[model samples]
Target: MHSQQQGWAEQQDALAEFGQFALSCIDLDLILQRACELVARGLQTPIAKIMQTIPESDELLIRAAVGLPRDIATTGVTKVPGGHGSAAGYTLVEGEPIVSHIPTETRFQVSEVVRRADVVVSANVVIGATGEAFGTLEVDSLAERTFTQADISFLQNYANLLAAALDRHKAHRERVANAEERSILLRELQHRTQNDLAIITSMLRMEARRAKRSETRRRLESVGHRVEALSLVYRRLYVTGVTDAVNLSAYLDELVKRRFLMHGLEHDDAVKLDLHLTPVEVDHSQAVAVGLIVNELVTNCLKYAFPLRQGTVTVTLERVEPGKARLTVADDGIGMPDDQVRGHGIGLELTPVLAKMASGDFTLEQRDAGTAGHLVFYIPDLRGGGSKPL
Candidate 1:
């Protein structure tokens, strides 16, 4: 009784260990091989095999084996004929457990693999899959021994565990495949959007060049700048492959570089960008809005602030509080000028609208020497598990 109880305890421990293995492993062959080792050791059988059903044939493939001859073990291409000829094949085809004691085992003809292994007793159990039999997990002993009801029960339960593991691994693979497909689609969409925006900006500039009115040209160029600002965010997103949030500091840094390149102001003698930006992350809407606002403010600075064409437009980002950030653009030139500070032009007039879109507000104040503008907006909880994140 004690021996039987000890065997039962070992089987239970094997099942628990197998559960952990199955959870972490997606490799089917490795899983089957491990299961063979466990079952063989648990049942005190020295030789074991896992043979899978061959499609539309009376044959089984030896997918994995332990404590068996090197020739009998699978190299991904070992097969045994089915239909009561071998224990593994019979169990797989019949979809049940079977035990054959060699002395009186007329139910099976000794196959070449088994014949060489010198098996005196064999126990085979079916490993199942979704709505069908997957294969057979069998154990063979060189010394004749009877597998008790409890022993057979342990084998059947282990087979059940294998069935569950196989299905779970299949599901995991499908999920990974689906995630990759989505990522590909996102990249394609971003590429097309960048191309579309490029065409739109080119057309606007072309129309501006042909216009008779200076105001008309300026307004068209302004619209093009806004579109260009929005487009840059998408371009950055495409390059980074980020789906949920955009890094604010990196985007702003790139924006300054872009502005310089667009108007041939990249030379050190021209208006330079003095960026002291702190890293922040926000959703798509805020990122786009923030980009546009920065472009407009900086454009106004370049258009009016510096008369000598040699000054710095300082852009700073600060985290004032949790879930809130402040972006400021300042210049030592002639100030924001005109009705821009009181909310007019593309920069000021749209400030309120854009700020609301970002779940925030905007303010402007003239310093002793230069003008400073601020847009305080919500920074998403990228860390999650909160209504808002710093």
Candidate 2:
């Protein structure tokens, strides 16, 4: 009775240790190795191994083992052929644990390692969380030994724990792959959209050039510029590989340079650019609205503020507070009249509306030399809100 009680106590201790190991382990290879080691120690077996099923070929490859020859464990003896006779193969196919006296068993061919090791007893259990088996967990002894029903039950429980861990790892791998695929598709879509916008901008330019009336030509040119501003946002997204937020500093720099080049004033010494931009990240829809506002303000300065085409336009973006940003577009040229600033021209009318779309406030003020337009808005915290629709 004392011997029986001592055996029970040891079994309980082994189970407690295994539970702790399983809880702490995250890597599949580590878990498998530890499980095999623990099983070998608890069962007093000469060999304990885990064989993983290869889904493509329906073969069992030895993944982890203890008390097995290095060559047999690591090299050419890796795979166990799947069929009716092999103990591991049968356990996987039948989805049940089996214990057999290897010397007398004839239903299936024993593995070469088992034969060479002179193993007398072999036991195998299916390892899987669901009904479908993933592989087999096997234990063998060189001395003749009989495993009772309790022993078989204990091994099956261990196999079930392994199966659960494997299933979790498989799920995580799938999620990572799915996220990558989505990112690729989003980039492709942005590229195609930018191409379409470029085509439209070209068509608008053609129409503006053909117009005979000065007023009609100017209106067409303005519309073309607005479309081009929208196009620039998509271009920035493509170049930066960022789908969630726009890097304000890089984006505005490119935008200002492109605008000067478009107006045939990139090399003009009189027209200078003064940029004092800080790094900031803004959501997609907000970025588009800000881009349009900047385009309108800069276009106004180019056409009206600097009549001599020989002045400076300054663009500034700065984070004013924890969740706030301010953008300023100022020029050192002819100032706007109070009445025109209040009037409903394209620049004046659209600037305030676009500011509202960005959830910002807009203000126009006459500086000592030219006009300054200010836009202040709330920026989403990095920990939360992502891009929202315009």
Candidate 3:
């Protein structure tokens, strides 16, 4: 008799191992099925069933079962009462564990479907972290058998593990959803950037065509170059997976390389561009304004300043203080004439306008050399976070 009992206990331990392995390998449905199987075998019962709460629904649905016919067990929906009864629903509602040893009728509003079970024993164990009702584990014996506290404790622990697994699945699903949303937003932003570039190109082409003279055409072509520089900044931003703002130094270097320097100025008389930039980030509007301002300054240096000669056009950017920045464009070329200085020319007029857009000031002056010109401007920092380098 002692040897036989020891063998049976070993078999029960093996069944527990199988239950754990099955729960690990299978989905929620299979976990429930495996739970029913384990409980039925451990309790030496003829039938076992697991019931779960339907989200937003007051009814408890039979999720899994063993031994009993599925068709008979789930013939109808079972409405669980709010409190104080022997039914699984009532046990869950009252936040308590319950067990029944015999096929006893309880006024817990258990459906007629469950009334058909001749031998029934059930235990309700709260599984979730918040002590919320996760489900019910039930074992039915055709013969009378004692239900122990150890059995209830085992079922409760397994149910808790099952709840954690379900929560992990839910979190993963939400992460996937959030990733999909970000992908959609990025695609939309790319589409809008392309549209903006196309429009700017069209505008530049029209403006260039309407110019009556070669000089005017040249100037408008320079404007088109500026627009393209701005477009390149956005393109790099899109490629780098950044959409908010851009680093000024890197943007300026890229702009100069792509736009003006591509012309390959060989002679000392030809305009040579240089940059001295401080790390900074600017919003889209300020970036555009800065891009256009640089375009105008560089174009003017190549046109009027050098006057058919080579020259060095230096563009320097430095952070002056917490919220202010200094930008200076110095060209070693013929200084501005007194007559031309009054109106400040169209490009020079744009300098002040761009500076105002940045909420700052602008200045134009002739260097002490008497042959070179300098334009200094200040603009407010838009990025309140940390400074960035392009």
Q: Judging by TM-score against the true structure, name the best candidate.
A: 1
TM-scores for all predictions: 0.88, 0.82, 0.53
Report the C-alpha lDDT of model 1 over 54-73, residue by residue, as the tens digit: 77888888888888778665
Candidate with better TM-score, 1 vs 2: 1
**Cα RMSD, each candidate:** 3.4, 4.2, 10.7
Q: What lDDT is reached at residue 36 by model 3?
A: 71
What is the alpha-carbon lDDT for the whole of candidate 3? 0.64
Backbone clash tally (model 1): 0
- Higher-lDDT candidate of 1 and 3: 1
Cα RMSD, model 2:
4.2
Candidates arranged by lDDT, highest first: 1, 2, 3
- Judged by whole-model lDDT over C-alpha atoms, candidate 2 comes out at 0.81
Per residue, candidate 3 scores C-alpha lDDT tens digits across 98-190 of 665445645465444455665555556665753565666656666666656666666666566567656765676688799778857975786
RMSD (Cα, Å) of model 3: 10.7
Give the 10-residue window scoring lowest on summed lDDT in candidate 3.
Answer: 369-378
| Top candidate by lDDT | 1
- Those runs of model 1 whose alpha carbons end farther than 4 Å from true positions after fitting are 54-58, 83-85, 102-104, 108-110, 129-131, 320-323, 381-390
lDDT of each: 0.82, 0.81, 0.64
